[model samples]
Target chain A: MANADRIAGSDVFRPNLTGRHATGRFWQTAFLGATTVGILGLILLMLNIVNNAFGLVAYADGEDYLKYSPIPVEQLATSDLVVLLTNELSTGAINKLNAEQPLDTRSRSDLLALVFERILDREVVASSTLAEAVFNRQAFEADALAKNPDARFVFKSWVTTDFLTVPMSSQALFAGVRTAILGSLMLIGLTIAIALPIGTGAAIYLQEYADKSLINRIIETNIYNLAGVPSIVYGMLGLAVFVRVLEPLTSGAMFGATDTNGRTILSAALTMALLVLPVIIVNAQEALKAVPDSLRQAAYGVGATRWQTIWHHVLPQAIPGVLTGSILAVSRAIGETAPLIVIGASTFITADPSGPFSGFTALPIQIYNWTVQPQAEFRNLAGAAILVLLVLLLTLNASAIILRNRLSARRAN
Target chain B: MTQALSSLPVTDPQDRHVDWAARLRRKPRPVETVVQGLLFLCGAISILTTLGILLVLGNESLAFFTDPEVNVFEFFTGTHWQPQTGDFGVWPLVNATLMTSAIAMVVAMPLGIFAAIYLSEYAAPRAKAILKPTLEILAGIPTVVFGFFALTFITPLLRSIFGEDTVQIYNNASAGLVMGLMIVPLIASMSEDALSAVPRTLREGAYGLGATKLETTVQVVLPAALSGLVAAFIIGVSRAVGETMIVAIAAGATSQLTFNPFEAAETITGHIARISGGDLSYGSLDYTSLFALALTLFVITLGLNLVSRWLVNRFREQYD
Candidate 1:
């Protein structure tokens, strides 16, 4: 104790306190700056998405509505709009529209859409982003209209209800991510169906059944390593195996519906299942490990078999965690673009992915497709798709967290 | 009724199995056996996935290297990477990858490490909760979105700041910058774990010796957690190297060897994504080259992963 004060007084390890505090303050500022950068990055990302999702565009091919009907275009009833559309469209075109969806039963908006698409044939030839439209409207309208005097300049919200309902089109004005959204849902649904039970089973084995054997250890390590593998390599594997080797099954040739090749939703879903398997297994193992030993002992003491104990007790206790992991896995699968691109998702598919065997594109793929295009309007469209994808991701993660919290709360009780 | 009577009353501890010989000789439960077999099959899927990746890459890479136009030595050492003119050198792709990854590390390391230190050592619990989730949101963003962000926002920002003459529309610097943002969450989360693992005793020891809080963190705790921090940094590097969509979208599609971050170039992943998206005939050299690139990526990430795992285990054992 006497030596401690002497040591503190010694000049050897002592530094000037004021300089030390100054250095600490400087480092603290630098660290706070670092944290600020991350938050700023996130803010900019959201702003970019919103700043492009709605915009003003200079579009060509508008005709006077008075020429086709007595009423104005916006005020026209469904029958009036249909009349205007039928009078303007050719017989073959009418038949095609009818075949696509019944024209007689179509709503006013549908008929108006038909009139605009088929009769007026509006296309976004040029555009300004939401920021440009909002902050500098006069300049945007002046420049846009001057560039294309024949074109109509109007405000366009890229995430309108029609944008959610319409199918893909070559023209950016008419393009929507409906098919892509449907495909993503189908892929995530099928992927969860395949991955959940298997991932949970694997976790059960690793946590409860497998002993400290060499093979089990190897399997455990492999799962961890696989979790870290780049997702693109999984796409390559899918292309080589699911698309080529298992084409007969993936393309539905074995099921006698061989309209397409192996680049179907089934193949992509299968690839994603493999991609997320390790993540699910790891999370599920943590969940299973959290199950109390007392529950297992009680089950065994009651003359229950090991399978019965796992199935009835351990599994029921771990269900919330398993579901949480599966949801996270699904979120990862939905945002994945490279693998879908490699496994041959059609960027131009118009038809909704009707089943696992159907050709598909996803929301992320749609974003990528549009972002790569040279047109500025396509970039706006990509922003809208990104917003949708982000919303989906947030929803999935939110649900997972809520599920975990509720289950853990009940456990605490 | 007899079954009910016999199934009753096994609760007495004194009624424990007396006949050990008979119990040891009892028949195995068939239902339990089948259930375990099913579970084992489930566990085997991960093994099958690894095997599948290896087999697919190996089989196609075999076809690629054996082709007459391709030279093994040239493939590794050559500067050019055009497949049309029979040039299969991977260095251009490698260089672009390195340039972007180097830039990414430059941006990510200091920011990520500093943020980790702050979150672990300086942040209060409330600040930690809000900041950590916000960082995760940064992490949870899809890379394709970052790609779009890079192209639409970061690229234009750079072009305006530096002037269009100096910066290309699809420069490596923009992609690398956004890619660094994408990787910050990984480094921060992992390194926070490492820093958190440094025992409290060490910090107290530093404080006892007239060390300030910052001094304790930097001199004592940092050294104690160096192994895990290095592992986290290595993984960050690996992620930056393997990142695809950002480079594919923001970095240029053409391959050339250049260390200049302002210049446009294609990475290995960017090249593979570009070519494979196009219409390539099956079994062509171009298609085979994709597998080769994938194999290279796989091997690199796998090696980094193994080393990081080893380091992490060592660090954990030190504290556990």
Candidate 2:
């Protein structure tokens, strides 16, 4: 016991003197703190988007009734239902209600909007009070009397076929993404058509033909530079070249306009093609470069002509790579909005594009337009549109991944 | 056989040449020459496209420079970007672009480098496998989503913490922050490859000397991977410069040349976005100015990418 006390009382009782330990602890904590902050920032960003996009829906002051039910005609005992219906309907004449439903005074003005919304297309409602009676007594009365009123009852699915069918409207409840989707599809198709051949041809020439001269070195440098050029620069180029220089041809033949303001779908698509062309060419060249020289030599050893060797052997071997690059380029084109918007893609396109040169709106532009609206419903519409854009982008990316995997597997084999 | 050959050579010179030519035709030709030619042509065309892009951009910019309104000094120094008012100073836009890109580098470089170090030297195979793909998914997400995320989410969060006064409805910080997140995977992936390229023998030597793992990584591996790390940072900067939608949506378009991150400012590309949307006539100074801006952006980013390529190539050579 005395020895133990002596040992404890000796150097072991001295203050901790390992300065390195303290420094190590401090550094570790700092590193952990930084990493935690980064991850937290990412989480906070995602949660913020969800909160704004998914929280309680808000309706405009005058349009709040769209979520409620219409008044019941049966509650008006003595008065003629037809006269009462006409009187109640005229109250909000500016609301664009149909004359089909019989007058129901008990329903709030907001609930009446829903009744008119449901009956506007019904032909039987045009002549018969029965159409109004059924809707008025059941939906209008029940919705109006519910104790704890909710807006979800009138909630429209933003992912429905109608979302891709109907045109956009100021009424957030009726607004759909049909025009934007169509525009995006058209733009993607046009971009592929324009970018694929030029990009592929450039890759082919670079990998299959160029001499190892100073000129080739310069070209290589230039290609790298072009790839690094900002996308908005391409937008400016599109505005100048396609919209201005070729306006006579583009606007005249495609958009039926003579002025330079003819920012047709073709102009936007062409601009995007230019934006992604360098990417495709670079990727394609890399893929072509990966093809083994042994294969080319083997083909040549068989006394096959150069053209025949490349066509039958080298090209076939490089095709998977080229296709992979093309897929990536197309995906990039689909998500691009800045160049398109810069080249004058319409923000308020109502009709779906019918041809390559028609004026159109893209998904991103639609989201931007919706986000700027004064009403809360418009914000919801923007969220729904964003979801659509995300899904489309994912689909494109997935296909590219599948293609890349397949190519790699083939190469492995 | 010798006597016959001698007799044939004794005949007319033209007849002998014809006979030699026929024999040469019978022999198999070198088809590899043709294949080499084709490959050469492919390389040439790739070069041609690059030339075409430069020619197009250069010609348009030259046309823009001829206009008296586009004074180079004013464009580089002037603070206001009110193109409608004929005030075309590019300083404010440049400031915004530089400020956001700087902030993004600050956020991305350290985290990405650390993550790369962890993956290469510290993490198990299972952890690496899971982390790599998750990071790639982060990279693959569309920039539009990032923009939406910045505008809707990042901005509001900044508002709550710093108060609305500290952050604008559209501020540079949110855009820069999101951009950094977007680029982290890029830096991490590339830097990991660079760090892994360091010879294991060097690491083992450090261990033999009784150095700790952290010490070996910092003192040996990091220095060895310096060239590659620099390349990654430059590439990250190039990406930040070319980035459009995030800044356009999240960073406001005021064009005030101040250094304040809270202010709504325009970028060179952002100015192009604004001007291109207007009704500027073809060949007008405004329209031509867009091309000049494009050329400037092209030159800057191109320089950055070349430097990055050079560094990466050097790093590869050192080990190879």
Question: Across residues A1-413, which tens digit of lDDT does each residue of candidate 1 receive?
Answer: 88987876778636676678889999988887898888889999999999988899888866766667676677877777777777878899889888888788987777876677767667776888888987998887777678778777888888978788888988787788899889998999899999988998999999999999999999999998998888889999999999999999999999998678999999999999999999899989988988899999999776677888999899888888887888779878889888988888898988888898989999999999999898899999999999889988888778778887888788668
Per-candidate interface DockQ score: 0.69, 0.32
Q: Output the lDDT of residue A350, model 2.
A: 74
Interface root mean square deviation per prediction:
1.4, 4.5
What's the lDDT for residue B1 in model 1? 26
lDDT of 2 by residue, B131-153 (tens): 66766656765676677777777
Best by TM-score: 1
Which 10 successive residues of model 1 chain A have the least lDDT summed?
A63-72
What TM-score number comes out for model 1? 0.95
Chain B TM-score, all predictions listed: 0.93, 0.86
Task: Give candidate 2's error at residue A340 in angstroms.
Answer: 1.1
